[model samples]
Target: MRLNLQTDYALRTLMMLATHGGQLAVDDIADAYGISRHHLMKVAGRLAELGYVVARRGRGGGLSLARPAEEINVGSVVRDIETLDGFVECFDAGSNGCPVAGVCGLQGALSLAVGDFLARLDRYALTDLIPSRQLFAERLAPTSPSTSPP
Candidate 1:
């Protein structure tokens, strides 16, 4: 199952924050990932609302992870951030027009696949995904806003 652009951007934003481990502006994250600012702003806002990232507004203020990387589970993030529904045509009865919706094993199999995928994701955290804090720190540049923080 392909994750939506929002989910992808959310993950990218989280990973970038994890790497920098410092205050980063939304623009910095968008530029770092080469994603749209409008979309990233939504992702960052949702992340802050969800307590994944702490957002501050003032001088020298920006965004940073609310907790340590090791504490933030990747799977939980995906599950919480993603709109997990309609893996297949038969998954949603409202839009499902499949003739064999009830009997077809495809839906059940795909469900299992999605479950397995999520389960595996739950086993990993931001730290686990990074593998090396040193490498991340070295690669990620710290964000320095020229003007007062928004």
Candidate 2:
């Protein structure tokens, strides 16, 4: 059950906001993860639309978690941001082309596996991902030229 890049970026953005506990510019998040600002922007937009994050535009504008970190369930976030329909061909009943779709036990097994995967994630929250906020912040902090390796 692999999450697409969009879902990956969405989770990363949420985790950063959860750790920062304050509004952060999209560019800052992108720079921290060495990801494309454009791609992050799209993910941020989707997150904002989903009511996970508050996006403010204009000067001093930034993104911030819409609710408390502990209230944001990891599974819920993934379900909201991820398109699981394409996980397996049979998962999408309308587009399923498998000849043995009805008789194949693999689809049912895969379904259970995906359910278990999400169930495990349901046990965690955004805050759980950042066990040490201080350490996370420190790691994400920009490095000065003096601290940069040759």
Candidate 3:
């Protein structure tokens, strides 16, 4: 199963925040990942709304994780950010237009698969994704000497 760009960005953003363990600007994240700042902003906004992140505006303000890295579950984050209903065309009854909608076993199998996928992800936390925090921080902010792992 493939994750949509929004979910991918959300996971990456969490990883970055966990690695830094400090406030990070949306622009900085965008620059590091070579992603769109606007897209990251929307992701960050959603993360803030969901209580996974804390966003502060104005000078000396930026984005930071609301809780410690170990407290943030990867599966929880994905579930919060993803629309699992659309994993397969037949998963959504109201909008499904597939010809074999009810007669096929694909939908049921896929549903179980999705559940297993999430269950496996539940075993990991944000900290688990970055085994070497210092290395990640260095690679993420190559030229920025001020950035370091906490």
Instruction: Please name the candidate that would achieve the greatest lDDT relative to the true structure.
Output: 2
For candidate 3, write residues 28-50 as lDDT tens digits: 89998989999999999999999
Model 2 alpha-carbon miss at residue 73, Å? 0.4
CA lDDT for candidate 2: 0.93
Better of 1 and 2 by TM-score: 2
**Model 3 steric clash pairs:** none
Ranking by TM-score: 2, 3, 1
Better of 1 and 3 by TM-score: 3
Q: Which ten residues in a row have the lowest lDDT in candidate 3?
A: 141-150
Off by over 4 Å in 2: none
* TM per prediction: 0.85, 0.96, 0.92
Tens digits of per-residue lDDT, candidate 2, 1-150, equal 468999999998999999999999999999999999999999999999999999999999999999999999999999998877678899998999999999979988988888998999999999999999999988888899999779
Q: Write the per-residue lDDT of candidate 1 for residues 10-113, one digit (tens) a residue.
A: 88888888888788988878776667999988888899989999998777777899999889998889887887776677878899999888887898888889
Instruction: Count the clashes in each prediction.
Output: 0, 0, 0
Off by over 4 Å in 1: 142-150
